[model samples]
Target chain A: MPNASEPPTTSPGIVRRFWWRSGQRTRLAVACAGVLGALAVTGAAGFSGDARLAERGGPGVAVHRGDSFEVTVRAVSGVDLFEGVEPGTGRVFGARVAGVSAAPCWQSQSLAVAENLLRGKKVRLIVKKDGDTGTDRLLVDVELPDGTDYARTVVDEGTASADVAARGELGPVESAARLQRRGLWAGGCTGYRDDALAPPSSTPQTSSTTAVPTTTTTTPPPVPTTTTEEPAPEPPPTATEEPGDDEWLARFEGKRCLLEGTRRTSPKGTEIVCTRGPRGQLRWQRAD
Target chain B: MRTEDHVDLFAEAVEADPAPTRVDGGRPRGLTAEGWVRTTGWLQVGDHPVSSVLLAAVAGLLWALVGAAALVTEFPVAAGVLTLTTPVVSGVLWWLFTTRLRPASTARNVDTCRADELEPGDTIRLHGSIGPIGQVVEVALDDDARVVLHGGARRTWARDDVVHLAELLR
Candidate 1:
């Protein structure tokens, strides 16, 4: 009979040997993970460092360009940004003009107003830290040097509408601007289109009106404090009445004009000049 | 019937019928059962799913990309906001991904095993605690209802510690 023997153990193949020997694959995986971790850390740090470097504009400048919004000025210690707010750290920060909602078409006009009023000027910022807007810009009530409300000016000029959430004075100002068909509201907001301008019935359904939030009552409460250092002058009276079929010149009043120097004679023989409005849109105004 | 004669007979039987050598102790050759299960879209590291980790990584990458772009454009406030909220956003996303993927049965598996039910040499993974796989050493269910487990170190854990008891197939 043959002698009994133990079966021969075959050696592991190259792949298995590589995988199991001293946990080589695990070490490789760990190393790869470590590299990825290092990259992520480096990327984050680089981004943060770049952001920090970009925050400041220049030393000793009173009004500086904001890193996020258009401008940044110090709050408190007489940075002259807002009134009746607690003093802050005086660090430069971005501030959003409260109570104005500038639609896309009117954004440039509102921005122009902001730049003119705020750039190289001392202003006040009443900061509200109630909730996160997902940006570093603070929600604030901005006031120009002459104590004119910045957001109110934008709304009153019809460059922007009152924010639906706005309380106090801005709502009434916006409603009055809309009623007068000022700036963007000219020719019922569809003045840019020929058909909408010819027919008065289609005026109410214009898409531009949708930007105004109708949730707030159209008639706002009377503002108690009307006394101000510089009250905005009332817009010059244009031909506001709905035009008859024969009245061609009457239709051009408060409507966007093509040329800056264009002049037309009204039925009353008064000269009307196409002049740029406060909201940056060119409209026919009575020649003073 | 003698012990020596029986040992010699067993040795002769083993030589007569030799079994084939299996490197993985006759278990499935390529991947372990757990590894095969992981391929079915339920990958996890301990209690957290691998998908959550990957999702958080992608989110972090996007956050970094946007932040870098914002910084290059000199929008420091936007970059600051993105940088500051990265960890929070990643954490929330990881939590959401893990919550969405975790199987209902696996979550309930923690309550299934107790110290009294465990026997010596039973291998288990604990929930809500970070440690290596534990091998039950002793089940001391006296006052504290703790089980002694030997993994790298011998330690006593509560009855509720065992999240899942796994049987290794060989």
Candidate 2:
């Protein structure tokens, strides 16, 4: 650590000028203090953090009445023969999968189910047995609010009464099982691998010849929306830190406003046309 | 005229309007580069709450930003930017403050031309938003010797523009 009295010995010319002008110690100290303060806030929030107790979605997992989405409940990881916990059944420690985790996991694991079942209110995906109950986990889709009009589910639970099939492919156990019944299942295990992934099998895709047009069309639209949305948002928190650098905050604080939706008007009759920010919350007295 | 002649003209125009009143908002009321440029303390800027708020905001915001930036990124340019901005922002802010707060100075305009009536270099009271909202440029006389009023925006108007102002005082 450099001391204040030491005068910050460094490479003399431009480098030294840069550090001095930058208020090196002051800035670093402030930044560190801010980070530490944020960490403290996070810890405080953890105590208040609500952890949803998810119920595993079972075979009879009720799908919502209308509007479609995916739900995933971890099935198993390692087989527990000694404990009588079946390869794909028995008590599974539940981790709730809501609309957030459902859509992605479904698309990645079961493309067919993702395409077809995802369009309906209820989506179910099952792959062949991977290894054991402890190592491999099952995912389930469940209805929300009993008779649902498509709402997001956070924590869902159900009984594990699912079909057990050959340890063939790494696709959804129940799905691969159904595919087994039809003899149409293609991709199962990945070739020449000891690890319990998929078996030696062809790609699950049917009509693989016209790969050009389908790949071309589906990739672009969602990428931009998803990429732009991924950045750390400036906290959409309902309550905000009180009045920071923005001077105009005072002008609107505790005042109701009917923002023309076109422009923000100041209390003193100054119409400010801007979209970026007043940089803080403006209290307003809504005009009607 | 030099490149700064336009600025010099503005300075002169404003200075002519009220020389003793144009206080630099950057430095303290009394403290100039020369140090302790005293004020009479009558028209202290603190009298207006709005002006004080504008002053505090302009100064504190700039400095606090410098402080925050130095705290966050620790870039060399932050301080440099702040130093260059202090005076410029202060001047602009002061202009804003005064434009809204300062009462317009009075100037007189009369059409009657008597030999002993209106003395040269004499200050006169004029009734209008002109003296209050904008500064008065130097008074000029055209070829006909008709008195013409010059305003801040370079607009020249004769006594004909003032129907009520001339007739009411008549």
- Tens-digit lDDT string for candidate 2 (A79-164): 11011111232232221222222221222233322221122222232222222222323332233223431112110100010222
| Stretch of 10 with least lDDT, candidate 1 chain A | A1-10
DockQ of every candidate: 0.02, 0.00
lDDT of 2: 0.27
**lDDT scores of the candidates, listed in order:** 0.44, 0.27
Question: Could you tell me which residue pairs clash in candidate 1?
Answer: A80-A123, A80-A124, A81-A123, A81-A124, A81-A125, A82-A124, A82-A125
Name the runs in model 2 displaced over 4 angstroms: A1-112, A119-288, B1-55, B58-170
Highest DockQ: give the candidate number.
1
Q: What is the TM-score of each candidate against the true structure?
A: 0.29, 0.18
Per-residue error (Å), model 1, residue A95: 2.0
State the lDDT of candidate 1 residue by residue for A1-288, as single tens digits.
000111111233453333322232463475457547756776677655544433531111122233122233433221112212112322345455567665546444445545555566666655544423222455667766777777776666666666747534666666555544555544323422212112222222222222333233232211112123343234343455333423645666787553465565544556678789999767987776
